[model samples]
Target: MYIEFFVNVTSKAWALPILSSLHAGIPGRQATLLTATGASRTSFAQSMEHLIELGLLERNPGHGHPLRPEFRLTEFGKESAAIAHKINSVSQGEDQDLLRRAWTLPVLASLHTPGHFNDIRRSLLTITDRALSQSLKSMESRNWVHRSVNVDARPPRPIYSAINTGGRICQITAPEISFMQR
Candidate 1:
């Protein structure tokens, strides 16, 4: 459920940033969050609506004009926001762009213990082979993931593991993500 939570929450490009900023104590008014997240108006609105739909956020009923309403985190939102804040804190510079991708964090979360292609695909039921392959290759080029061949395997399979910043994030998140039974 925890891993799935990330999968849902990260569906929007600005979700993590918005959650992170709110968790960091930035005011939840639209203008403040918009400026802090540096998200464009349309994407930011979409992300905010998505969060609200997910029950992670809700408008503060008594605050601000309707056109520029304030928002607040629900209890679930707070929990998820804490995780988002942790992820946001560790990501730096170029990594920021990669982390914003829909599949990246969920994929990294599954890499906590290192897995083969099939293992990862099984863990994330919704990911396509090509998407997983592309995400792994991209992270590999960034040095966030380490890929090694298992020569002992009959077909010589490639194993993937999170390293460095990716490893740290995995350590932080994977323990909390409940893996679904096969």
Candidate 2:
């Protein structure tokens, strides 16, 4: 599912930045990703290995020294990178600032359909209640998510939904979900 893909890509702090750098015209080499993303050597190596393991990146068999492989985005990686590009483009101002934080995209994606706090938390799997609450509040402030109270219930329940702008982000990132599902 897209949530799984979202988690996979975001699990590493440097993953998005590496993908963004590559998509932004940086060469697909360790040195380039490292320089562009400003990731420490260890983090860069780990992130590159993770991306390669996830099938998002493939090393060029004939290029570079064996110890320093030149990488390129696979078809799946290209699709994922494109979606990342769109996500970056769709966000602005506070929304853009929020997207820089971990779990922001996944939270927005989870709210594609209206969900209660528990539902969104369940979708994210690894997110803590506090983190989810903070993310949702930040998104609410940015107008990316709308929260409403279900007073009709015995106990009022809060429901969260993606606004049109949030929906646009989810739509743009849909390919990542499909790509990972494959």
Candidate 3:
């Protein structure tokens, strides 16, 4: 669950700090903690690859070296981490007052309506419009939800619906379970 949470925020860019420490000489150090609090080598590599593809991270800037390029966060990568922190603070109940307000958000009760973007936005304690958009897109891509796009205007408006059709919005994906096995 924690890994999934970070995946949403860091989007693989979460591995930047670990990769940057390649030369630090800690051969078997745990880079990030999973929701279960277990750390493994495979998950770390996979996370690195995911972030690399997203362009949130890249090989170290130095051109010539025998060592693999160190990983570093792009500007966007930092922003992503910041946004994740804000969302997690509220969602994880780190802030009592914020969480209370978020619970009152209409989308929490009526997520079936495509027109509830504003409500969802308001419920999040500190997430930006961009993060909300990304979360919706990620949820839609994972088949947890469906997006209804309104193409009748200059900027498209998207409404979301549960893909499960039974109101299920969350599920453990195969990779998530696989990580646990490691």
Candidate 4:
């Protein structure tokens, strides 16, 4: 249930940053959030709309000009925002970019224990084969994940494990996320 919340909140690239910024006391105005997040206007707007749709955000009834409305976190959104804020606090500069991607954290959560490609896929459930492959490869290049061949297995499978910053993030999120285990 909590993993679903994380995955849903992260489906949009700018979503977590927007939520984290809100939680950090950055006023929930669109222009301010866009500037703070450094996201393009279009993507930022889309993400904002997505958050609203997900019931994480709402238009503040009496704030700002109509054309420049302010938003606020809903009860559920506040919970999610705290998690996002904690995760963001651990990363800085360039790492922020990677953390905002759709599958990164959820994938890292799946990698908390070393597993094969299929194991990760099964855990994420909604991730496609291509997306999982690409995410694993991307994390591997960053040394966030280490891949080793399991020669003892009949087919010499590749096992994936979160390491370094990725491992830290996995641990940070482990308490909230009870991901499906093989």
Candidate maximizing TM-score:
1
lDDT of the candidates, in the order given: 0.89, 0.80, 0.43, 0.86
Writing each residue's lDDT as its tens digit, candidate 3 over 25-56 gives 23222332332223255756676677667655
Using lDDT as the yardstick, the better of models 1 and 2 is 1
lDDT-superior candidate, 2 or 4: 4
Alpha-carbon runs more than 4 Å astray in model 2: 38-40, 65-68, 92-97, 174-179
Worst 10 residues of 2 by lDDT: 91-100
The TM-score measured for candidate 3 stands at 0.33
Candidate 4 structure quality by residue, lDDT tens digits, 101-168: 89998898777789999988988889999998988888898888999998999989999999888988
- The order of the candidates by lDDT, greatest first, is 1, 4, 2, 3
Task: Please report how far candidate 4 places residue 102 from its true position, in Å.
Answer: 1.5
| Residue 76 in candidate 1, Cα distance off native in Å | 1.0
What is candidate 2's CA lDDT for residue 18?
Answer: 78
Q: Per-residue alpha-carbon lDDT of model 2 for 7-40, expressed as tens digits?
A: 7887776777777777888888888788876779
RMSD, every candidate, angstroms? 2.3, 2.8, 14.7, 2.7
Q: Report the C-alpha displacement of residue 86, candidate 1, in angstroms.
A: 0.6
Clash total of candidate 1: 0
Ranking, TM-score, top scorer first: 1, 4, 2, 3
Top lDDT hit? 1
